[model samples]
Target: MKKIFLVAIAVFTLIACDKKEVDADANIHITGDVKGLSQGKLYLQKIQDSALVILDSIIVNGDSKFESHIKLDSPEMLYLFLDRGQTNSIDNSLPFFAEPGNIKIETTLKHFFADAKISGSKNHDLWKKFDSINSKFRDQNLALMEKRLKNELKPNATTTDSIEKAYKSLLTRKYRYTAHFAATNGNKEIAPYLALSEIADINTTYLDTIQKSLTPEVAKSKYGKMLNEHIKERKTLEVQK
Candidate 1:
C-alpha cells in the first residue's frame, strides 16, 4: 500500500509541473541570439503613456543568446533595446510587434535593426509589409527635396515653386496610402498603431474613417485608445480656431 501511495504522489507532482509550464507558456516568451556580441544587456520594452517602459531584461555574460518573458494585456508594439556598453550609441534598438507567444529575433551587433530577422508575430509581418512600400515614398520625397535645393542655388522662382508643389503632392499621397492601409487592416492592432504613429497629422476625415473601421477589440487597444484621444484633441483645437 505504501508503494502504491508513492506512485500516486509522483503522478500528481508530474501533473502539477506540466500545468505550471503550460501557464507560463501563455505569456510572451522572447528568445534570440545576437551574433558578434559577447556581452551586453537586452531590454524588452513598450511605450506606456508616451513613455518607454522596460518589461523585462537580461544580462548576456558569455552567451550571445538571451531570453526574456513578460505578460501583456494586448498585442502592442514593443522595442528591444541593446546596451552594448559603448559610448557611441547607434543602431541599438530594434522594434518588433509582440503578442502572447514565442517570438524569436536574430541579428548581429554590426547592423542591429537592419540585420534583424524577427518571427512569431503576425502583426510584425504586416508592419514589415507597410514599411517596405512606405520606404519608397520616403526615397522619392528625399529626391524631390534634393532637386529643389539644387534649383535654389540658381534662384529660379518658377522651378522652386514647381518642386514645392510636387513635394506637397507626394506628401498627400503618402498620407492617403497610410490612411487606407490602416482602414483596411482594422481587425489588427497594427491599424490603430499606424494611424497614431504614421499619419496622426493627416486630415480629420481620414482619421475618423480609420477610427470607425477598427474592430471592437482593437479599438480598445493601447494605440486605438490613443488614436481616438488624438482625433478628439485635434477636433477640439480646430473648433477653437
Candidate 2:
C-alpha cells in the first residue's frame, strides 16, 4: 500500500510540472542578427500618449545574434533602437508595424536602419502599399515642377492658375483613393491606420464614415480607438463654433 501511494503521488507531481512548463504565447518574437555587434543592447519601443516607452530590451553578448519577445495587444507601429554608444545619433532606429507573429530583423551595426531587413508582418505590408500609392501623387507634382524649371518658363498668372488646377486635381484623386482604400479595407487593422495617417486632413464627414465603417475587431485596435476619438473631438470642436 505504501509503494502504491508513493507511485500515485509521483504521477500527480509529474502532471503538475507539465502544466507549469508550458511555453508562453509570445505576440512578437524578434530574432536579430547584426554583424560587428558582439556586445550591445537593443531596445523595443512603442509610442504611448506622445511618449516613447521601452517595451523590452535584450543584450547581445559573445555572438552577434539576439532575440526578444514583446506582448502586443493590437497591431501598431513599433521602433527598434540600437544603443551603439555613438555620439552621432544617426542610423540607429528602425520603425516597423508589428502584428502578432514572429518577425525577423537582420541588419549590420555600421548602417542600422537603412540596411535593416524586417519580415513577416502583414501590417507592414499594408503600410508599403499605402506609401506606394502616395508616392505616385508626389511624383506627379515633382514632374510638373521639373517641366517648369527645365523649360525656364515663368509661371505667369494664367500659367500659374493652370498649374494650380492640375495639382488640385491630383490631390482630389489621391484623397478619393485614400477614402476608397479605407472603406474597402475596413476589416483590416490598416483601415483605421490610414484613416488617421493618410486621410485625416479631408472632410470631417468622410473621416467619420471611415471611423464608423471599421469592423469590430479593427475598431478595437489602438489606431481604431484613435480614429474614434479624433472624429469625436473634431465634431465637438465644430459644434462649439
Candidate 3:
C-alpha cells in the first residue's frame, strides 16, 4: 500500500508540471501596431534561409492593435505584413538562440520594423507597449495640427474659418500618425510613405460624419487641397520608387 501511494503522488506531480508547460506555451503573446490606421492586419511567417516555412496571420482590430502566440521549436525570421495593402515589413530574422517562450514586437510603420524585439513577458507588456506608442503618436499629431492651423488660418473669419480649422485638424491627426507609422515600421516592400494612398478615404470618412456641420467649400480650401496633393505625391513615390 505504501509503494502504491508513492507512485500515485509521483504521477500527480508529473501531470501538474506538464499542465503548467502547456499553459505557458499557449500564453506566449505576440503583438504589433500600425499608425493612422483605424484597423489593419498583420502576418507572421516562419522563414528558413530567406524562404517561408509556415505562415500565421492576425487581424489588427479597427483600432490598429493585434496579439497572437507563436510556437517556436527553433529560431526563424519573423516576417510581418500589413493587411491593408499587401505591405510587408521584416524585423531582421530573429535567431532565437535562446529557447523561445514568449516574444513581443510593438511598433508603428514609421519605425516598427526599424526597431522591434522581444519586449517582455509577451502578454501584458506587449499590449502596454502598443498602447503607449499609439497614445504618444496621437498626442504628437494633435500638437502638429494645432501648430499648422494657427499658421495657416485667418483669425477673424467665423464659420468658414472654424470649418477649415476642423478639417485640417482631423486630416493632420490622421496623416501624421499613419504616415509615420508606416515609415517607421515599413521595409523595402511596404514603406510607411505609402500610407498616403488611404488619405482620401480617411478624409472622406471624417468629413462625411461632420458634413452636416460644415460646408463643402470650406473643406476644399487651398490649404486642404495642397495637403491632399502633397500626400498623394508622396504615396506615389513610396509605391513606385
Error of 1 at 1 (Å): 35
Clash count of each predicted structure: 0, 0, 18
Q: Model 1, 230: alpha-carbon shift in Å? A: 1.4
What are the runs in model 3 whose C-alpha is more than 4 Å off? 1-27, 48-50, 84-99, 115-118, 121-241
TM-score of each: 0.85, 0.73, 0.32
lDDT of 2: 0.82
Off by over 4 Å in 1: 1-26, 87-89
Q: What is the C-alpha lDDT of each candidate?
A: 0.89, 0.82, 0.48
lDDT of 2 by residue, 6-77 (tens): 999999999797542223766777777888888888889999888999988777778888777778889988
Candidate 3 lDDT for residue 74 = 31
Is 2 or 3 the stronger prediction by lDDT?
Answer: 2
lDDT of 3: 0.48
In terms of lDDT, the best-performing candidate is 1
Tens digit per residue, CA lDDT, model 1, 108-127: 98899899999999999999
- Maximum-TM-score candidate: 1
Give a tens-digit lDDT track for model 3, residues 1-241.
9999999999999978754223344534565455555665566665454467545566555676666666654322355655546555453233221114555555565555445444544222322344466566567657756755775675545655665676677667656555444334322112211232334344433322332222344235332333346656656765796
